[model samples]
Target: MSALPRPAHGPGSRYTARAATTRPRPARDGDVAALARRLTGRDLWLARMLHEHRVLTTHQIARLAYTSARSAQRRLRTLHEHAVLDSFRPLTASGSAPEHYTLGPVGAALLAAHAGLDPTALGWRPTTTGRIAYSPSLGHDLGVNELLTHLAARTHTASGSGLALWLSERSAARRWGDIIRPDAYAHWRDGDPLLPFFLEYDTGSQPPARVEAKLTGYAAFIAATGSRPALLLHTRTASRDQTLRRRLAAAARELDLQVATSSADFTTTDPWGPWWAPLEPTAHRTTLTGLAAHWPHLSPAAGLEPTDADTPLTLPVPPLPPDLGSGS
Candidate 1:
């Protein structure tokens, strides 16, 4: 007997596409007026700078907004609290302090929509008739973060039995500075503590030169652990870099690293977060050296493991609290 045909894709994929739209939907006017006002006002100024620059520190954002760093920080807090902005840490050259306050995915979407707004005296209007107007929602960020959290928690049991660890540019740089930072770091956390499987999520905007450098970085980092680790890469569009990806894979193997072209080779979940984060240790170590190694300057966390008490990760129904704004 032949094996049952695999589901086409996704949980609802087998259902007719027409059945998907049972509920009526309202076309969003958005807070177009409010959004426009913010865009033209001080509130959106930092967002605009972040959009133009891709990322910025609170100081940089403040300079663009002509506000004090503290004021800019407050605005940043508000934006993040409202899910209007997002932030991630990147290492300073010293790898001692991590820089915060950067445009997250949600912020990027809002800025994109604002930039695409129709220019008129009547102010902004939804372009739904001709081309749809898109407004990024906190829902979107909630969804993405949820997925990331889910993958981190579930990667070990995933079909691929991979480990997932969330790592930042700074940690990555400190560990593999000789190579390159791969934008985001994801590691499958199964066997060896030192060299768990890792991957990079490249939206395909990575330059060919940069791609080579990062490929080398992964190789070096994996080699340092003296273990062969999985190194997968996913790009939104692989058309342009087919050859580059092929080269990277070959290079990874030459260094005894397993390589995958896309996350698909590794998992079946669509929302199976492409991001991975390190796990919180089950037991806290008491020594100063251990504390320093584990959480750095950050004090001991309250709860150690994932549980209902901890925020629900990856489920987007009710938006999760902003990880940064909560100031935990």
Candidate 2:
């Protein structure tokens, strides 16, 4: 029998002990390629998702990618041990936090290859992740992800629906522009029309006016691209929702934008369902699917693909009209 290396017992033992025990075996390029080849399409998609979102908890990953936690646990462990994924458990006053996973070096390389981009351009580093694991904003970021991840999850079981695309704040900035990068950009198809929306999770910290001002950018972006995606705002409470709703209405009327407001304290079992209310105070709460009908400027679809090419676009002036005006 061989004696294992004596565990460190001094300061930083928490990280040191854990690191020593679960160190993943290094996988060569050939090994990584082979493993990557063997991965199901879903596995690759999950990897791409981690790259886009920065981090995801074990529970969130399960809900987003797998039918159950038991199954997710088994495959995630395999990916972790094979150096395809990395995770950390934050030290917390409540004992320990859930295992939050991100793309490993190998995983990042695979994703970069798939995207036809440089691995270094992905902006991922182990040290950065370590720092992020302890940041106070981690909880807020995860909560935003959790809300969107659940919507992605529902696509699997929900009828005639799909989670077509989800872009994080960073991705949104790169794909669109930072003039208005949402917490996430989600595009999906529900029944007849394709729905595209942006999500903003507010913790009641930023002043209401500051949040409302972002609508100006969104309006300008929509005018330029001919893409009209609703802006979804989820707040800390119904009271907060009401307060924002007033400002959202003013913005919508002033800038000719489309905004939906909601509270995190939901009464329904399904969080993705009908919790959203349009900026209008008289409007009834509606589901994500029902949101598009109320906004006349949105681009809708009868098929899987978006109908942007066929839809006429407009570049309206500052403070656009309720309708973009002069659309072909």
The model with the greatest TM-score is 2
- Model 1 residue 299 CA deviation (Å) reads 28
lDDT of 1 by residue, 242-266 (tens): 5555556455556544444443233
Report the lDDT of model 1 for residue 259: 48
Estimate every model's Cα lDDT from 0 to 1.
Answer: 0.38, 0.67
**Collision pairs in model 2:** none
Off by over 4 Å in 1: 1-147, 153-164, 187-195, 238-241, 263-328
Worst 10 residues of 1 by lDDT: 127-136
Q: What is the lDDT for 9 in model 1?
A: 54
> Which 10-residue window in model 2 sums to the lowest lDDT?
312-321
Instruction: Supply every candidate's count of residue pairs whose N, Cα or C atoms clash at under 3 angstroms.
Output: 10, 0
Tens digits of per-residue lDDT for model 2 on 1-328? 0112322552222331243136665577678778877776666666666766777889887766665677778888877776677776655557766788877777877877776677777676655455455455676688788877777666557866756666677656655564676787776567775667888888888899999888888888877766777888888788988888876787687776678888778732355678888887588898777886677567521122334432111111111012212121
